[model samples]
Target: MPEEIASRRSRITPEREAELHEAVLDLLREVGYEALTMDAVAARTKSSKATLYRQWGSKPELVARALRCTKPASLREIDTGTLRGDFHRMVELSDNAQMAKDTALLRGLAHAVHASPELHQALRRLLMEPEISGLDEILRRAVERGEIAPDCPAIRFVPHMLIGAFIALPLMEDRSVDQAFLAAFMDSVVFPALGV
Candidate 1:
């Protein structure tokens, strides 16, 4: 095939790309990243393996794209005007209910990251960096508002503390982080420690 003809034929529309990405997430949720094959994704999305390979280049790339697609857009914009409020929102947003469907997906990803250096790097770049950027923006806004001191140690640890509970408690207690837990965490732990 001519280069131009091949290029034209390979061009995937944005909607199609989104559909494929959604299919990938669904497969991730169902079977997990380790078991999720490009052939399965193509079959689920009604596309071909050639199309998936053409678009994402590799399984890691496809998994990265799928993981990125599942992230809530609300994570990017969390401005509740107060540090406490922002922390609460972050906890609520990171709750187990939101992540309940992805337990297998996360486990699979954890395994993949442990086994493959390149996939680990790609996963960090694609999944973690954006979330860190969003959390940094939230913390910066809190500092600007004077809700927390510019040099507060809590500021540095807040994201990890909040997200850690979500990731840990579910495994330990087998329960979701509810509003009551969020409120108590903020009142007893976060606010008190931050001196807010």
Candidate 2:
């Protein structure tokens, strides 16, 4: 089944695939996850629903894959020689407008995630786990450099802290946090907790 899906998906050119994913994201931004349908995506992209289903299998998988495509780069690619430097670099790399848009998209998806096991599973597999693993690598590097203790209790919570900061700002301030705000969050909350 997986091989069949892969072969079927391989029929589309990369450019076409990217266009379809972008169309999905645009629809997601406009309607939120609950209202985003394969019909809508097909209509927007001038593709067939049968093709979308053949390539992606289901709505959750399609949405998860689309969201993953939007990520700038893998966190593992960042190696700044220091955890603080890497954290700040991440903030610098993120565009404020896109970040805000992504934040809103994620917020909209949160409820849908809870209701759909397939969405939760697809998101964890395609998006969340890779990022978490990359973050773990960053923390491991910090431990290796003696910047943080090897046995530090805070290491486990770093992802949560970072995610919380991003999610909290929109809820608390009614606005998305910019690079400066995230940079300060790293210095004040994350670095201090890590005792760096």
Candidate 3:
């Protein structure tokens, strides 16, 4: 087969792309990962199936890109002169209205993630890495400020612990992760574990 032409192409505006991502997340919350067909997304967004494929190549790629875009990119700007203040800001992050939909989407995608290698990698790359990296940055700052030890083992898994609390609280406690709960967790669990 001959190579396709590379120069002449159309593009989507950032605003339109964001709208498509919002549609993807909303659909994922409603129909879930396994049942979320490209056809359905095309219909929901009033977009051509060919356009989606040409943009994302696959469902996993598209979903991953959408999830990645939902996370806050300004976390590096969260320094408040103290770890407590920083964590309080982190607590406030869970207060968004879409958090409920995001939680539902995550719960629905759980089973599919295990069954689909492509989707599993996509979620890890798009959804998890940035958050983990931000948390690591926080840990590094704490170490530099002597608020926590550089070699603290808990530092490595703080994100996991936070995620565990986020997931488990909804299941075991029948409540969403919120600012107050996270503040308590930080004071009682995370800060103590860090010996801060």
Best of the candidates, TM-score: 2
Clash number for every model? Answer: 0, 0, 0
Superposition TM-score, candidate 2 onto the true structure: 0.92
TM-score per model over all chains = 0.80, 0.92, 0.87
lDDT per residue (tens digit) for residues 176-196 in model 1:
566677677778987777778
Model 1 / residue 146 / CA error / Å = 1.4
Clashing pairs in 1: none
Q: Give all candidates' CA lDDT scores.
A: 0.75, 0.91, 0.80
lDDT (C-alpha) at residue 112 in model 2:
96
* Off by more than 4 A, model 1: 1-11, 91-96
Task: Supply the global lDDT for candidate 1.
Answer: 0.75
> Which residue pairs collide, candidate 2?
none
Give the Cα-based TM-score of candidate 1 against the true structure: 0.80
TM-score winner between candidates 1 and 3: 3
How close to the true structure is residue 45 of candidate 2, measured as C-alpha lDDT? 91
Candidate 3 clashing pairs, residues 3+ apart or interchain: none
Candidates 1 and 2 compared by lDDT, better number: 2
For model 1, give the 10-residue run with minimal summed lDDT: 95-104
| Candidate 3 structure quality by residue, lDDT tens digits, 123-192 | 8876787677877787788789988888888888788778887888879976677667778888899888
User: Can you give the lDDT of residue 99 in candidate 1?
Assistant: 64
